[model samples]
Target: MTKRQSRWAKALALCLLASVASGCALPRSGPSKSEIYSGSVLEDGDAFVVSVNDRVTRATSVTPVLGFSSEFLNAGEVGSDTIRPGDTLGLTVWENVDDGLLSSAGQAATALEEVQVDGSGFIFVPYAGRIRAAGNTPERLRQIITEKLDAQTPDPQVIVTRLAGDGATVSVMGGIASQGVYPIERPTRRLSAMLAEAGGVTVTPEIAQITVMRGSHQSKVWFQDLFADPRLDIALRGGDRILVEEDTRSFSVLGATGSQNRIRFETQTLSAIEAIAQVGGLNSNLADPTGVFVFRNEPESIARAVLGRNDLVGDQRMVYVLDLTEPNGMFEARDFAIRDDDTLYVTQAPFVRWQKTLSAVTGSLTPFANYSQLAGN
Candidate 1:
């Protein structure tokens, strides 16, 4: 080979090496500064901008009852008091007018003091059999039973009574202290009473969020509220259930942010920033402020439905994205909430992976001792 050709080859090799190294500076396949500031990913038409400093306003709009809007408004009531089908109905029958003879009287083993509406929407009674109790009030049910028993008993003195079933009894599920069914038969029995019956919440504080489902409506009940207010401390029903989810046992928090760990929280509601803080903030050397990503679980069906597909019904339907690059981002972290089973992912800066690749290449070129030294923390 000619000397000039050899020199050209060496020069070309140097140029190639330089280009490969500088390629790390290529525009990253990530959100840029402009995109971070503009929030272009959010749907424009129906989206609401929540600034870091925006005053947090909780939803106060109660679900409006269809076909009863006028009646509900004219009654000047903000919330409905009418019992719903899934709502608990506690019936207490006074045992005064039982048959005088032992043969006719209700036996302790046979007589049901309380009945629960099963999945079929029917309450199984001792002798009267399964009654459609979902929509009927205690008085209405008593009347129905009275009419049914007219042929057997004369004058059939029947007394229909209803006490609060909000806290009649419930079983503690998930991560609770003493997880079991408990009876709470009192007008003022608070949620603490039931939790106390079940021992208490699990030892871990990470999965401490308590959930209470009343029929079809599920709502998050704060640990404090179970004992805070008697009024808000809803009464338990026969079939009511209290689920005390464990703290985030295995979760990932990422971002231009805080802590990053596979941590658990006893409560379900964690703020976006709080989750980041839990994991350990962005690696100062490798974090891209504009490209922070939170890879949360999205309900496939809900997403499809919201995207205009009607076939997907009753699916969990939305994704939440938070950008912490804003000036007042800390407050947004405080107000931006999170749900259970969510994943917060903070993508590494482009230079980080490049550094890792370089380290690996160097390790391969070195002796075992040098490789170990490079890998040593």
Candidate 2:
């Protein structure tokens, strides 16, 4: 070959090499194709595999770690409603066919008189002066008053009834149609009953995110679960507060998915398979069937169980891959629970990367080839 032709050949080879290297070094939009499909490329403390059989067990085990307080699991049975400090008591005294201070001539009973329980939990009757009334059942208070007045009148009988007590009420706030304080009228009033009394949940509020605040402690449960499981419908206590709000739990879809966006769960629990369906499934034309990945920051306890170690970095951040090409992958996805704020990614196929690289090289070399042909002429 001539000197000019040899130099041109060398220049063309250098240009081609540079073009290929630059294409390979280009910044990726998301996780690399190899990282998604190859297990060897995954780093230590990077990813974990959840098989079909272990999916249910692993999901159920980690669910409590996602902010479910055990205190709300079992509902305590409510006992008889007791009197509070500000409760008014309707007192009635009776004497058997006798005209006394508490009764009239031939009258069986005296007129019902109202007595309010004082701040010190004491109420005064005509003969039974200043008796402890707060925290006692109405029947128990009646017996105490009757015993105290027995000697004053012949066969003296007493009856006590609660007249009004705003202090014995619970507050239902947040996303309810009618938010207010409701009086606990019955001994067996429960959470569901109180929600109904407050005009039910609002239209915009998420039914799956209901919270109950009792003093300093708070617990959360789905409205559907509260209704489905009678045990979760705990009995209401005085000063208890209920809050209904929008669901904040969500997951994001990125890369080669049908729609790349964040999706909120409609129910308390959602499986990985359901999440895929929610975002319109994978992009079949560009996605690799074996490259479905769920990126999450798993709890350290769970990471220890799955990875058999606790020394992982960055809060056990892991990428869990699912191979839809395998028959069992769909079944495993159905059982794998998707937690809040997780990321679901579907990576492109390996061939797609090569095709893109070759296309860039061909485009770059076309100009060089035209220059060489024109110079030769």
Candidate 3:
């Protein structure tokens, strides 16, 4: 090669070497292990980078607790067939006398198919006057009418049939298959049955929440728990408002993993290992098994337990490290619980930085090599 060509190649190669040697400028998914730890409070950084262990696992393994209180669970169940105000009754009245009070001229019976019980709880009949039908079952209402008409019309018989009405109905809304008013019938008196009639929940059962609002009282329970634990299936009430919500709790996965996304909780609670698996595990080519990390804001109580000290107050920023290369690493990761909004990041292996540096060096030398080859010709 000519002197000028040789001098050009040497200058370019030196500049490339200098730039590659400065690994800090290399493209990476996130900060390296040392870089992340450099930001911790122990190193005058923003977070406490604690190594994963049995104590850390217990200190961080917290899942959301959701359920109904005693008042809600112990509330009495109303019979689905019970009568209530604003109900419409289908009544059939019969009389043995030739000239009946309610029957037409040649008819022994009269049909009152749509006898509505007024808001005041009374239904009106020609011979029976006004009688309280609310708070009484169809059979009880029939008996009440029979006694009232018996005094005027001899041997009077009465039949009352309950019909679908605004009374004793619940309004189901939110993330449900069918959103509307559902009657509290014999088949749907409790929360679970009513949810089924509403075409079930539209979201994942583990994260779906069922909320019931009755008058001044309200209660909530995990949708899956409703059937898992029968006690959560509280009775339905008239004018009750039920809401079914979608799975909203999620955690973000970043750094050297298969993909970076906010993953929704598949179950009520999840372990760090499970969460990592959900995001397609670590990036095999670049992930550093020795530098797995979890970033979260732990509550005061949890911070105290994790640090083994009571001096810390309020929520504290925590950065947890998981080294899968250790003997008990996998077990520790499996035991470490993942909470909502936690960040899972796997640092790129140190060799990855060196690889990036090598790649840069090779790329920068390609033109020099081509120039020298052409100059030799």
Candidate 4:
């Protein structure tokens, strides 16, 4: 070979060796042993690592913090409105004899009159004086009045009806189309019926986010499930407030995925596989099939149960790795539930890093090699 050709060949050989060395030095595709067990260390905190099977088992075993059964939701049922303070009672008294205290000599029965229950829950009656009206139902108040007037009037009869009561209404607000206070006119007025009376939820109702707040306790049920399951269409109570709001539960995708953003759950429940699909799945060219990970902050109770470690670190955070290269991994992903605010990360494949390094070296040398070729010609 000529001197010029030999020199060119040596230069090419040096470039190839440098590229190979750089490629070899690139980080491996899979996580290191430390990273697999303890997770990639962050500036603020360390991520705890767990296997996919362990994560699935832990997730399946976890009891939901927020859930309501038909029976539990029905427990707040206000079957009938009981008289309460601020209620106006329509009372009528009758006696066989004309000249009774409630009725004049010319009339046998007294006309119905409105009597307001005071703040102390007592209503004034002509003969019965101040009577307790708050805790009693309308029927019970009628009986109480008849017994109290029995001594003064002969064969006295009494009728008690609630004209207006504050406790007889339920408020429907939030994402509903028509927000208002609906009256519970009947004994069997259910939650679903009240929501319907308020013109139903607004456009694109997030059924999974419906909440019923009664007194100090609150319960939640999916709007669609409330309609589909008759049992969940629980009877509503007086003073109950129903709120329909957008679904706030979300998970985030990061690293080598197609996109990195927080995705809200469209349904009541979302699985890990579905969450991945929401972010456009993993990047085929860059993602490492064996290095998919999910990071979560677990409740202390669940963390203790799953890890069996008394160490507080186990309770604070957990990292779950999924090997999508395996066929069963896809199945397991479908079954695994993803909770709110979880982080899903797909690491870059080792080969991808090596390829990028080699490509960079070759690209940098191309102009130099071209100049050498021209000079030789």
**TM-score of every model?**
0.45, 0.73, 0.88, 0.71
Which of the two, 1 or 4, has more lDDT?
4
Scored against the true structure, residue 296 in model 3 reaches a CA lDDT of 94
User: What is the C-alpha lDDT profile of model 3 across 45-74, one tens digit per residue?
Assistant: 778889999988877878878888887788
The parts of candidate 3 lying over 4 Å away from their true place are 1-15, 174-178, 201-207, 368-377
Q: What is the C-alpha lDDT of each candidate?
A: 0.49, 0.73, 0.88, 0.74
Per-residue lDDT of model 1, residues 1-377, tens digit only: 45554565556555544654555533333443334435433544232223223423121111111121222113221112222233354443333335521124563112334444555567654445667765565667777766654545443434444433432346679877677766555421345667767777865553355777656655554465445444445544455677887434355564434554566653545666666666666668767654544443335443443344455544332334455677666666667655555566555566665775565544433453343455553
Candidate with maximal TM-score: 3
Off by over 4 Å in 2: 1-28, 35-61, 65-81, 91-115, 125-128, 139-160, 203-207, 308-315, 362-377
Tens digits of lDDT, candidate 4, 1-377:
45876687678768775856554544444443334554444434466566677455654444234456555564755545588777778888878986778787799889667788888999888878889998899898998888888988887888888885765678988988799887786633787778878888884654346788878778886777776677777777667788888777778888777788888777666777888888888889888878888778888767766666676543467787788778788877777788888888788877777677777667656776777677767
Better of 2 and 4 by TM-score: 2
Q: lDDT winner among the candidates?
A: 3
Q: For model 3, where is the 10-residue window of minimal lDDT?
A: 19-28
- For residues 243-327, write the lDDT of model 2, one tens digit per residue: 8887777899887878999897776668878898888887777788787878787776766666666676556656677777787
In angstroms, what RMSD does candidate 4 have relative to the true structure? 5.6
Ranking by TM-score: 3, 2, 4, 1
